[model samples]
Target: MARELRGHDLQCAIAQAAAVIGDWWSLLIVREVTRGHHRFEELLAELGISRKVLAERLRHLTDHQVLERRPYQTGPERHEYVLTGTGRALAPVLISMQDWADRWLLADGSLTGTAEPDSAEAARVHALRGTPVPAPLLLPATLPPGDGRAPGAASRPLDVVADARATVLFAYPATGVPAPLPPSWGSLPGAVGCTLENRLFRDAEPSLTAEGVAVHGVSTQRPDEQETFAAGEGLTFPLLSDMDAQFAAALRLPTFRAGQTLRLKRLILVVDASRVIRDVIYPVLDIPAAVEEAGRMAMKVVEGP
Candidate 1:
């Protein structure tokens, strides 16, 4: 019979591994870093982690060579934590844990859109399905002109990138504005908070603009209908229409079935002047908070490469 080791000092590999990352928060921090929440403020906001605890765990991981702190700002001395090679190697372990949770803990898919899934997440999804993960998706050089209104106009293809500003495209399903929602709209999978979400984005426009990020709302609604809603709400930003789903096809944006109508999932894409997608916010359950998140990401991009 084999003897059991003790005190996180066991001779076995699993015991040593547990000693390093057994804490729930420790592994979650790694997961967050893997998901690109590198900045201290970003991690704090996204993880809801207290400063003291986060600091301790980050120090622990840094000491153990799991993460390397890189300086991103100098005047105030700001830093971002990046996963070291050793840290990245643990991705499979996390992926396996996620797969187990997906099968048993999250069978109902309650965690579908809590965070933007990066390439590692994509790999995990494929792994769960026993398939090879596809390569990272590349954004198109430029967006096609899609049907929409520019604040009190009819449906037409609006040139998305002609202005050369970093744009936040907040896409939703049909909104309950300018027209009464269809009877079962709320019951649809991704349509519950469609209007409220857009309202949140609109409210955050001032803050986003302060950061030099232009905010635009998007949906499958006709240009005329969007125009009415924008005018009624006194929205300062234009809402783009993709009624034909042409833009959807170009980006292969995710969607959910809403009876006969396919509704765009709640997605926020931070697109830069170069027409490159810089950041993505998905599964936006908390609409108002998502605007703040988008702002942070846009600023991060503006900060550097």
Candidate 2:
């Protein structure tokens, strides 16, 4: 029988491998990076790790050449760390960790959103090591332009992006004056977007079909450029880009009041084939409106036209 790596042993292959990545945090850092987390603030926000620990982990990973630092901009000149080839090799390791944890961590850590599938189904998520995962199946469903003669008919769908994939969609809405939702609300949309997108991806393959892709536009180069992009760094998916207003106008979403700024209304689209949006979800304060609609829309999209 093959023995396990142990203390004071340097000859075993496992021992050698352990020397490089025996630390738990190292693996986590790898996981986050693989999930498209690139900036310092983004990582801290996701894992809630202390600054000292985060700094140390990043330094260690970089020192070992698991990540490569690149210059994304020159104005304020911040640095982003991308995965090195060695780091890319951890995909299997992280996949296995998530798979194992799904079985063991469910009772202890269900982490808010959708429930994990039963063990039988989840095991299938593992055997796919042989097949390439498909992209989210996005359909070009756009809302029909309301007649200019209408009074209060809801316009169309708002912005959509894959959070981790699109805030983090490639990351929402309201009326008059224009207010960014509270911190709590602002915070959740990103995670929820990430979760929903991931849920769909997990359920099937690429082909991330969504209402529309607006958040993708907002993530380009931080309209509010600052010392930290926390949720504004690089996005996992490509947003609609610089044209978020187009969605807001089409949807006739209400105006929000963030002090005095006029922000785009939060709208969720349900599109049909040929890019004709079928349903529209106005700005929601919580998850229910979006959730129920998204659930229905996903079924429709997955089932076809």
Candidate 3:
């Protein structure tokens, strides 16, 4: 639905804020920009907004200097349009909205029951004691709080280790657990593996191409983590299985400091041709930093005799 402009005075803060964001559609537009989405057509597809509304909003934002555009390609078909500095600055707002939605809006919810977590203390105590609360702790299911891991528990352990060489090994943990590193992943190779992804497929493919090398990221969407690489557009590598998240836990990746669900922390690895370690970067919020460092290491690995 098109948003109504509600205001009488320009001096009013609420009215001014509304004038800027003003509608559900505009706010969503800003969100699309922050998620590394730039091209007008791409944003249109992602937001699914009508052309009339999108064109109007884009014009409005451009007028307010909230976004700046640049050309990407040209010829019989000239393609251009990108988010400028102002548009890039909207990252926090989008991130905040995402965080809020994660809390109030359910990623996946059923008619189980709607209620906030009962006890924050209950959550911590179970974690601190190395005990696993039943699925009902977060999920409303069979009760009986106890260690989620039991002796002779039948489960595959995906083992990952970043050695001193900055290389990482992905193996089944049943064999052995690798030793700890020097307390930093700065030494590992630059690589990013995306789990099965429906949304950011294009975003994850750049990690393999020479041009995509620095901004490089690989997706592991396949069940077997099969490897694939297209020269430019599609993903260049296999995706981490999204099935059970065994690959994630093997790396001992932690998604949030809160010790929440079994979400694997996003990671970047840099591997040598011989596949020796160089540097590893985890918990990267700034993609440029992570990718650049990996790129630097990759170049060094190539240059070394």
Cα lDDT of model 3 by residue, 1-305, tens digit: 33345555556766766677767887777665543456778778988888898888887877767777666766655443455666545544454343344434543321111112332312322232221111110101111114363423332222122112222211111100021222322222221222222114334324434432322222222222222222122433222332233222222222211112222234455544333334554434444555556556655655564
Poorest 10 consecutive residues by lDDT, candidate 1: 130-139
Cand. 2 Cα-lDDT: 0.42
Model 3 misses residue 33 by how many Å? Answer: 2.4
Cα-based RMSD of candidate 3: 20.4
Task: Give the alpha-carbon lDDT of every model.
Answer: 0.63, 0.42, 0.39
For model 1, the superposed segments whose C-alpha errors exceed 4 Å read 1-155
lDDT of 2 by residue, 1-305 (tens): 11355776767766765656667777777766765567888888978899899888888788778888888889999887777878766654554444345435533432211223343323332232222111222222222223242422322333343322211121132211122334443432322343343233223222343433222322111122210221233233332322222222222222222322233333344433333344443333344445455546545644564
Question: What C-alpha RMSD separates each model from the true structure?
Answer: 15.3, 20.0, 20.4
Best TM-score goes to which candidate? 1
Error of 1 at 182 (Å): 2.9
For model 2 the local lDDT of residue 62 reads: 87
Ranking by TM-score: 1, 2, 3
**Cα-based lDDT at residue 28, candidate 3:** 79
